[model samples]
Structures are given as C-alpha cells and as structure tokens.
Target: MSETNSAMTLGKRSLMGLVLGLAAGGALYFVPECWLRDDFLINTVFKIVGNGYLNLLKMTIAPFVFASLVMGISSATDVRQVGRIGIKILAIYFVTTTIATTFGILGGLILKPGAGLSLGTFELSGQYEAVESSFADVMLGFIPTNIVASFAEGDMIHIVIFAVFVGVAMSLLGTQAEAVKRFNEDFANVMLKIVNMVISTTPFGVFALMATTVANLGFGIIYTLAKYCVCEIFLFFLFGFCVCGGIFTLLARENFFRFLTQFIRKVAMIPFSTSSSNATIPYSIQFCRSIGVSNKVASFTIPLGATVNMDGTAIMQGMTAVFVAQLYGIDMTWVQILTIVIAATMGSIGSPGMPGVVMATLVVVLSSVGFPLEVIGLIVSIDKFPDMFKTVLNVMGDSVCTTIVAKSEGEFDREVFYGRKAAQ
Candidate 1:
C-alpha cells in the first residue's frame, strides 16, 4: 500500500482497538466471579489500560484549562469589553442557574422520588478540602499572587483574571506590544495543539474510565437509587430540552428541536462521556464559532460559562437536596426551599471546576438549610450517573447563553444561526 493509505489503515485499526478494549473491559465487569479469578491476564489488561487512561486525562487538565483561559483572555480587545461581557455572562448564568435549581426543587417536590425511605448512617469517603473564600475573598482570589502557582493549582478564575490584565496591557501598548501579543497568540496555539494531542487519545481514556467505574461499582448502585435517578433524568431532559429549547425557539423565531438537533449533532457525545464542563470548553467554543458567534463573544462567553454557568449542577443540587430530605424524612418549609434556590445559585459561582464539586456544594447548601449531612453519602454512590446528564445540560446551557448573548450584541450571524452550510 502507499504510505498515505497505510497510515489511514493504521488509524482505523487504532480506533477499533480502543473501542474493542472498552467493550472487553465492560464485559469483564460482568464476568462470573469464578471466571474472573481464572482469567488473570484479562483482568490485568483491563485494569491497567482503564486506570492508565483516567490518569492521562487528569494529567492534561491543569495545563489545558490554564492555557485555554489565558489564550481566550489575551485575544480580547479591551478590559472594558471583557468587563461588559463578564457582567452580562454572569447575570445570565446566575439567573438561569437559579431557574434550573428551582425546576429541580419543583420536580423533586412533585415527584418525591426519595419518599418513605428509612434513615441510615452513611459514610462519605470523598473528602473535599474547604477553600475558605467568601464572595469578597473569591474576588480577591482572582488576583493571582503568582501566575505559576495559579496554573499549578488549576485555579481557573485567577488565571482568567490575570490573562485579562495582561491582554489589556498588550492592547494598550499597541505597536510596541504587537510582538508580545503575537508571541502570546503563538503560545496559545501551541497549548491548543497540546490539547488536541491529548484529546486524540480520548477513546482510550474513556474506555478505561468507564471500565473501572463499572467493574468496581456495578450497575447495582444505579438500580438501588432507581427512582431518584429516574426523576432527576426526567427533570434534566424537561428543563434542557423542553424549557431551554422553548426559550431559544421563541427568541430566535425558529424550531427549538431543529436547532437542538443541529447543535447536538456536534457536541452531544463529549460532555456525556467526560462529565465535565471545563473539559468540554474547547468544543463549546468551537460550536459557538461554527454557529457564527464572533470570536470575541465565543471566547468571553464560553470560558465564563464554564466557570459559573452550571445549569446541570444547579438541577442536581435542587433535586438531590429534596431527594435526601425525603430519604431522611425531613420536613422542608417554604422558606427552606427558597433558601435552597439562593444557596445553590451562589454555590455554582464558588464551586470548583471539578467533577464532583457540585456534590460538595450541595452538602454545604443542604446543611445550611437544616438537612442532615449523612444523607449526602446516599447520593454520592449515584452521583456519576446524574453528573453525566448534568454536564450535557451544562454545555447546552453555555451554548444557548452564548447564542442569545451574541444575538443581542449583534455578534451572531443570522445565516449561521439559521443552519446554513458555509464556512465560518
């Protein structure tokens, strides 16, 4: 075969190998105990590859997030535009998050998925170290004491703030700073190239992540919380598809389902598998750009959305709170429900860009409103399942918010929004 054809064949083989590996790992998870003990080689291969993939993804996260944020900020035109976009983005983020949490709470109340469950003392193995930052403290945290330290710690908010300041300074210097701006742009491209290199191995990582999860914690965990899981999934689809779609349709004067189908065809799988809003940032940014949202709007809104606009997390918080309350037979007053909405909304802003951060924030919010802390453990076992769905909604929310903001700011292309086939 010619070199090009040989390379293409090898690429297809590699892709198939990754898929087969994942399937084999998943199958091993359901193998009989006797078979598992006899199949030592099979178990060894599955464990090593699956665990190795997760570590690789984790390794890339800190650098990818910091670099992506820095690149985004450095590309902005001015601090004033950044500030304006920040404010608008945050406003929409908080409002929609509050609305999402409310829907979750409302759904929980009506569904009562956890109703009549007996209270049990459950232990939480996952420990979250509290970063003591009030609203003012969080604001102060944005000003990095050391850029390297911020990047090392993966403090996204701080990185974003520092990048904005540097970007502003670059813009101010104009002719003098052109070289620096160009260098930064090149650096950003290099980092993105690294991200692409890492993402190319995603199928391997995903297979391992899924295999380990299934093998260790079987589908039994989900079966146990079957009702609660069903209710949360129902609410997620309702709010994400029905409610958010309706708003987009009304605003854009187009069929919401059609728009969703177009967008989802591009982004649906990434968030579903990764279960992270931050990880999906690049995809969300590209999706916005493809739909004709300007670079300025896409960069500003997508990063900010990843940081604070957590519709899926909000929904989980509301529903999980009520689910726990029902499981523990705790009576929640009207005032308590209102408090949940407020706390969940605020918590989304403070929550770290980690997979289970919302679960930690949920404990804080629920405890603040007089719910038992042990109840959090009950939800933890089933957290990953709902989290996957929540992440999809989170990305969807960011895209919708970006589209709306771009439209209002006159940064959106009408033709692109209408799904015309053409280059961006």
Candidate 2:
C-alpha cells in the first residue's frame, strides 16, 4: 500500500510538472524578449533553478549507470549470458532504429513539409562547418583507450565497454565478485534515492524550462517549425503506441492499451520537460521495476539503452534529411535512401550521450547522401520541441526493449506488471 501510494504521488507530481510547463510556455509566449528580459527572469531565476535540477540529475547518471551495469553483469551466471543479453539489446535497438528511420523517410517524402516553401523563408547561413568523423572513428572509439579516462570524461560507450570487462572478470571470480556486486547494488540504490529527491523538484524545473524556451523562441520560430514538429510528433506516437506498444506487447503476450496506460504512459511523458535520457534513466528503471522487470535486467538494459538506443534520433535524421532535400528541390536516389538507413542505424549505435548529440551527428546522416549541412542552422532555432519528443521516444523504446528481454528471460513478473499484484 505504501509503495503504491508513493508511485501514485510521484505520478501526480510529474503530471503537475508538465501542466506547469505548458502554462508557463503559453503565458510567456506572448511576452516579447525585450519586455521579458533574459538576464532577470530567464537567466537569473529560471535558468539557474532549472539547470540546478538538471545538474543534480546528471550527478547521478554516470555513477548510477556504472554501478547498475557492474551489478547486473556480475549477477549473470557467466560471460555467455551477459554477451547474449548485450547482443539481444543491440539487435532490438538496431531493428527499431531502422524502422524509425524508414518511417521518418516516408514521413518526409509523403508530407513534403519543406516543399513549395520559398528558400527566402529560411536565411541559410554558411557559418557552421562540421569537422567530419568517419565510421571507422566511431567504431574504433568504442574500445576504451584508458578505462579511468572513460569514466572521468563520462564517455558512456567506452565506460560500458570498460564496465563489461570488469563485470566479466568479477563474474569469473565467483565468490570474490559477491561483495563487489553487493556494493555496486547498494551504490545504485543510493543513486536512485537521489534521483527521487531530484525528481521532487521537477515542477519548478519544468516551469523554468518551458518559460525560457517559449520566451526565447517566440511565435515566429514556432510557426516556422510547426510543420516539422507535427510530423515528428505523429511519427513518435505511431512508433510508441503501434510499434513499441502494439506489436511488441502482442509478441510479449501483454495487453497493448493496458500496458501503455498502466505504467509506460505514467513515466514516458517525463522527457517533454526533462529532455535528457540520462536524467530519465532512474525513473525509467523505477517504471521497469513497477512493471516487474528484474533489477538485473533493468539495470543492464536501461543504462545501455540510454547510451546506445537512438531510435528517435534515427527518425529525426531520416525525416530532417528529406526535409532538407525538399528545401533544395533535390530528389533522393534509392542508393542514398539505403545509405541513410544504414548510416543512421550505425550512427545511433555510436552516438554520444550528451544532450543535442543527435543534431551533431545529424551531419553524418545527411552527408551519407550529400544532404546540405548548412540547413542545420535553419533548424537549430526550432530543434528543441522535436528534441524533447524524440527523447521521450528514445526512452520509451529503451523501456520496451528492456521489458521484452526481461519477459524472454523469465525475469518478468506478469501479475505485478498488470497491476494485479503490487510491486514489492
């Protein structure tokens, strides 16, 4: 009863935060930047509090993920199980990312959001130049050059590599790994407690984030990006409910509507304000636990998902590529379309963990088929809205993958998942 009440309370608080964000954005949208004054309310008050909340969330992310991953890997019977789990998660991630990109391409080609618009609509600045990175660099970079540096720099992919090595070694050690695994579990719990505490301050953070965004972007930016935003949202829901919810649940033998509403919706809506999967990791893990995912699986999959799973980002790449192509009146060749699918799938795998990492790598996706890079600047002013929704999609995809893997492993508690039995 106590745990149920706590979750309920948290859900209400989260909803209230979202509402406050909407209210703030709507109210502030009417105010001119000159009248609003960025230094006073936007910076000193809103930015400070909002960024403080985000910082607290970031504070836990790397450590919590490290601890969780170590503990999860150590719990596995051997390296084979751990290897299998990693491969499965990555496979799911690849399939979903490819699907997302394909849909994104279709959305762009069909909707033609950028078609018939005058080039004069967007002032193209040839200002930003991307220092290109090869596919080889991305792949070779995954192996940790220095394990300590990976953790210190918060290089998640490398950290994952380093952590897995340590975990495998510990697992092979048997009795020796027991104490270390327990310690990692304890550390993860402490971080989770901190995450809950940080989440308690979300209402204020949401209010700040929304207000600042609207005040800064204003109505002009919204109108310009409205078409793109709509397409992204539609694709996000289509993928979330239909792909992740409908098809996945059917395969897992879980109720689609009931499954989404029962827990996923409660937690999945969070990234609208937070906008960072790193911050949302703990809450996602909490949701997994509530739905009866084993801690071992949740710990491994959630963090790994946050780092590697970029379905939403892949969608952004595909759609935005076509959107840009349309702006320039360039018809994409079939080979280029295939190139986007392949590059985005691989790029999402190697993408960085930082906020706005997608936009950075968007260049790679675009360059594969010779999509204009300068158009990136035009979209920058309006990327926030898409980024928020995409992050939600990214997080949801991760959760879905986690749940599916858990069910397959017999690590899921069905009664608890459906809310028929309370989570322990």
Candidate 3:
C-alpha cells in the first residue's frame, strides 16, 4: 500500500512537471518579439536548467547500465543456463524485428507518409565520417581492445560485451567475485536512486527543451511534419495490435486486450510522457513483478531490453528512412530496402535509451543507404513529438520481450498475470 502510494505520488509529480513545462513553453512562445524575442533572461535561465539536466542524464547512462547489467547477468542464471535463455531471447528479438520492419516496409509503400511535403532541404548538422564497418569490424568491435578506454568513452555495446565477460568470470570465480558482484549491485541501486533524483527536475528540463524548440522552429514545423506522426502512429498500432497482441499475448494465451490494457498500457504511459526508457525501467520492473516475473529475471531482462531491444525505434527507422527518401524524391530500390532492414536492425541495437537518441540512430540508417544528410535537417526540427510515441513503443516492446523471456524461464507466475492471487 505504501509502495503504491509512493508510485502515485511520483506519477502525480511527473504529470505536474509536464503541465508546468508545457505552460512555460506556451508562455514563451506567445511572447512579443520586441519585448522578449531576443531577451536572454527567460531563454538563458531555462537553457541552463534544461541543458544541465540533460547533461546530468547523459552522464548517468553508461555507468548505470554498466553496473546494472553486470549485476543482473551475474545474479540471474548459471553459466550453463545462459545459453538456453540467451538463444531464446535473441531468437524472439530477431523474429519480432522481422515483423516490425516488414510492417514498416509495406506501410511505407502503401501509406506513403510524408509523400507530398514541398519542403526545402535542410542540412543535418552532424559529421558522419564515412567509415565502412564490415561484418568483421562489427564482430571485432564487440571485444574491446582496451576496457578502460571503452569505459572512458562510454561505448555501450563494448561495455555490454566487457560486462558479460566479467559476469561470466565472476560466476566461475564463485566466492572470489562475491565482493565485486555486491559492489556492482549496490552501485546499480545507487545509480537508480540518482536517476530518480535527477528526474524530479524534469519539469524544468522539459520546459526549456520545449521552449527552445518552439522559439526556434515554431509549431509550424509540427504542422508540416504531421504526416510523420500519422506514419508512426499507423505503424505503432499496426505493430502493437498484430505483433504485441498477436505474437506475444495470443501465443502466450493471455487475454490480448487485457494484457494490453491491464499490464502494458498502464506502465507504458511513463515512457510516453517522459521519453526516457531508463526512467521507465522502475515502473516496468514493478509491472512485470506484479505479473509474477522473478526478481532476477525481471532485473536482467529489463536492463537488457533497455540496452538492446528497440522494436519501437526500429519501426520508426524503417518509415523515417522512407520518409527521408520521399523528401528527396528518391524512389527506394529493393537493394536499399534490404540495406535498410539491416541498418535499422543494427541501429536499434546500438541506439541508447536517452532523449534524442532515436535521432542519433536515424543517422546510422540514413547514412547506410547513402540518404542525403540534408534531409535530416528538415525532419529533425519536428522530431520531439514523434519521439514521445517512438519511446512508448520502444519501452512497450521491451516490456513485452521481458515478459516473454520470464515466461520461457518459468520465472513468470500465471496466477499473478491473471491476478488470481490478488483476488484472494
């Protein structure tokens, strides 16, 4: 009861934060040019608050993920059991991803979102230094040459690789690695606490972020890019109903609508509102636990889902790649379609769980097919709103994947899933 109340309080605070931020942004947007157009007072204050919060968030991701991942892996399963669970997880990921991208490809062709926008090309302001990473490079990149350097640079995939080895070593070392595992687990808990503290200031951060957005580009950009929302929504639900409802719920023999409404929709609102997967992890774990996932399984799968599973973002990539192509008047070829599937899949894996992360990942996909960087410029301006939905889908996908894995491992409780025990 106390825990539930705490969650309610937290949710209320976050909702208040969103409302306050939106109000401030609206006020800033409506200000007269002569009075406050270029005035740095409001802009300057919010920028510092907002950007500082963002930087603080950026600082936490690599370390938090590193600590939690190592702890989760070390504690979750025995070394021999890792292969069975790992293969199943990976297989589910690939299969569902195929469904996602297929939905994207067919949706892009049929729906033709962003088809007739007479928008000018805007240059994407990021350096995509053309470096061809072959399959060999990708395979080799997993093994960090210098573990210290990987940590310093915050290279997550590399960190994930390194953490796995450490975890395996810990498992082998048994008592020798006990202290280290405890330290990591403690460190992870501390990081999560810090994240909640940081998130408490999200109102101000969101205020400045939205304010900066509207001040520079104006809401007209949102209007212009509205079609992208249509595309994303279409794909989000299409995937949601079919893949989530069909593949996960139905196959599991759980009531489809009940699973969507009862389990997912409740917690999914967090990521949708906050647009941060890491922030949503606590709620996600709670929901999964309430549904009867074992603590170890929930702990491991939730963090791993944040790190690797990105069904939501992948769907966006498929559609966005096509949208960019349409903006440039380029008809996508079959070869390019295949390339997009590959790039989108890989990009989803590499994309971090942060604000504006999908944008960073869109770069990888765009560059893979030789899509003009300038197309990114036009699309980036209106990325904020779309990103919220993208995150909802992303986190929802993670929850689904985690639940499925728990079921396979027999870590899930059917009684809890259907709330039979709770009824007692």
Candidate 4:
C-alpha cells in the first residue's frame, strides 16, 4: 500500500511538472525579447537546473549498473543460465529493432513527408560530423583494458563487459566467492537507494528541462516540421504499442492496455522529458520489480538494454534515410533500403543513449546509402521533439523486454503483475 501510494504521488507530481513546464515555457516564448532574454532565463537558469539534475542521474548510472550487473550475474543459479538469458535478450532486441526500422521505412514510403518540398527551401548546413566506428571497433571496444578508466569515463559498454567477467568468475568460484556476491548485492541496493533519492526530485528536474527546450525551440519549429514530426511520433507509438506491447501480451497473457497504464503511471515522463535512455535505467528496473520481475533478471536486462537496445534510434535512422532521399530527389533502390536497415541496426547497438546523440547514429545510417549529409541540418532543428518521444519508446522497450524475459524464465510474479496482489 505504501509503495503504491508513493508511486502514485510521484506520478502525479511528475505529470504536473511536465504540464506546468510546458505551459510556462510556451507562454514564456511569446514574451518580449527584452523581458525574456535567452542569456538570463533559458541558458542560465534552465540550463543549470536541468543539467544539474541530469548530472545527478548520470552520476548514479556507472556505479549502479556495474554493481547491479555484478550482483545479478553472481547470484544466478548457473553460468549457462546467465548466458541463455543474454542470448534471449539479444535476440529480442535484434528482432524489435529490425521491425522498428522496417516500420520507419514503410512510413516514409507511405507518407512521403519530404516529397513536395525542394532541397533549396531549407537551409543546408553539414555541421554534424558522425564519428563513424565499424562493427569490429564496437566489438573490440567492449573489453576494457583498464576498468578504472571505463568507470571514470562512463563507458557503459566497457563497464558491462568488466562486470560480466567479474560475475562469471564469482559464479564459478562457488562458496569461496559467496562473501563477494553478498557485497555486490548490498552495494546494488545502496545504489538503488541513491537512485530513489534522485528520482524523488524528478518533477523539478523535468520542469526545468522542458522549460529550457520549449524556450529555445519554441512552437514554430515543431510546426515547421509537422509532417516529419508527425510521422516519427506516429512510428514511435506504433512500434511501442504494436511491437513492445504485443510481445508482452503474447508472452505474459495479460492485457496490454492495462500494462500500458501501469507503465505510464510509473516512468513515462522521465524519458520523455530527459530524452535519455541512460538516465531512465534505474526507474526502468524499479518498474520491472514493481510488476514482479526478479531482481536478478531486472538488474541484468535493464542495464544491458540501455547499452545495446536502440529500437527507437533504429526507427529514426530508417525514416531519416527515406526522408532525405525524397528531399534530394534521389530514387532509392532495394539495395539502398537494405543498406539502411543493416547500418541502422548495427549502428544502434552500442550507441550512446544520451539525447541528440542519435543524430550521430543517423549520420552513419544516411551515409551508408549515400544520402546528402546536409539534410541532417533540417532534421536537427526539430530533433528534440522526436528525441523526446523516441526516448520514451526506447525506455519502454527496455521494461517490456525485461518483463517478457522474466516471464519466460519463471522469474515473474504473476500475482503482482496481474494486480491480484500488490508488490511487497
């Protein structure tokens, strides 16, 4: 009862913050330039508060994820079972991403968002440079030569790899490593407690972040790219509802709408406001636990999903390819479409989960099919809107994936998941 009440109160507060921020920020955008100066309000006040809150979330990620992974794997019944869970999770991620990308491409084809517009109508600045890394590089970068540096740098891929190594070793050591396993479990709990502390301030943080975004972008940009934005946002929901929710329904044998309500009631606003999958990890795990996913599965899957799962990013990249092709009057062949899918899928894996970084991933996808890089400039202006929605999709994907896998592994508590009993 207490847990439910706390979640309810937090949800109400966070939703209120989101609404108030949008209202305040949108109204502020219409203020006279002399009264509402960017230097004083948007850049100074909003930037500081928003980034400070974001930093608080980032501060917990490296240590929290590391400890969770260590504890989750160390406490597993068997090493082979850990490997099996990993394989299942990866398989689901791959399928979902591919589906998301396909849906994005099909949406672009059907909607033709850029068909009527000429390339000269919009400003083309090839200002974004994609730091292209190959699949080989991404794979090689996973192993950390120095674990301390990985944590210091907040390199999630390396952190995940090192933690897995330690976990496997502890699992193999049996009774000799029991004390270390307990320490990891206790440490994860401590990190989660800190995360809870940070989460309580979400409403305030969300308000500042939203206010800053609206003050800068204003309403016009969203209107300017209305078609493109609409298409992207539609795909986000389509994928989230049809793909993620469908998987949950098919596997969990529960009502997806019910699940959706519960999900939104828990952590929807954080991802939407922050535009970050990394920042939402702790909350995703917490939500999973609330629905009866085991700590072991929740800890392992949620963190890994944050690192590798990029369904939303994949969707964005795929749509961008078609949108750019249409804008440039370039006819895309089957070969180019295939290239987009392949590149987008591989690019999303190990990609950074921070806001706006997906633009970098989009560069790789566009470049793969020889799309003009300048088209990215137009997308950049309206990227935040889609970024907000896509982050929500990505985070939801993480929770759904965690829950489904938990069910399959018999790690799910049906009573709690179905509301027959409250989470203890």
Which one is best on lDDT? 4
Per-residue lDDT of model 4, residues 197-297, tens digit only: 76677677767776665665575433436789888899898888887878888976777787789889999998887777888889998999998889999
lDDT score, candidate 1, position 52 = 54
What tens digits encode model 2's per-residue C-alpha lDDT throughout 27-125? 766766653465677778887866776566556555655565566555433535567676677667768888988988998898887765533333323
Q: Model 2 off-target regions past 4 Å?
A: 1-81, 118-224
Q: How do all models score by TM-score?
A: 0.59, 0.59, 0.60, 0.60
Clashing pairs in 1: 50-208
User: What's the best-to-worst order under lDDT?
Assistant: 4, 2, 3, 1
What CA root-mean-square deviation does each model show from the true structure? 9.9, 9.8, 7.6, 9.9
Tell me how far the alpha carbon of residue 327 in candidate 1 is from the true structure, in angstroms, after superposition: 1.3
Candidate 4 off by > 4 Å: 1-81, 120-224
lDDT (Cα, tens digit) per residue for candidate 3, span 1-424: 3433443445455445545655565666777764355557455676686667666665666666566556655653343555666666656765676667767877877777767653455443222223455666545645679988877865545566676677667767778888987888788778766665665565556556655555554565345467777777878877887888777765455666766776555687788767677777888888778777777777767766775677877888888888777765666666567667866765565345766545545655665566654344334334556667777777777767777887878877889777788511
- The models' CA-based lDDT, in order, is 0.64, 0.67, 0.65, 0.72
Ranking by TM-score: 3, 4, 2, 1
User: Once all C-alphas are superposed, what RMSD does model 1 give against the true structure?
Assistant: 9.9
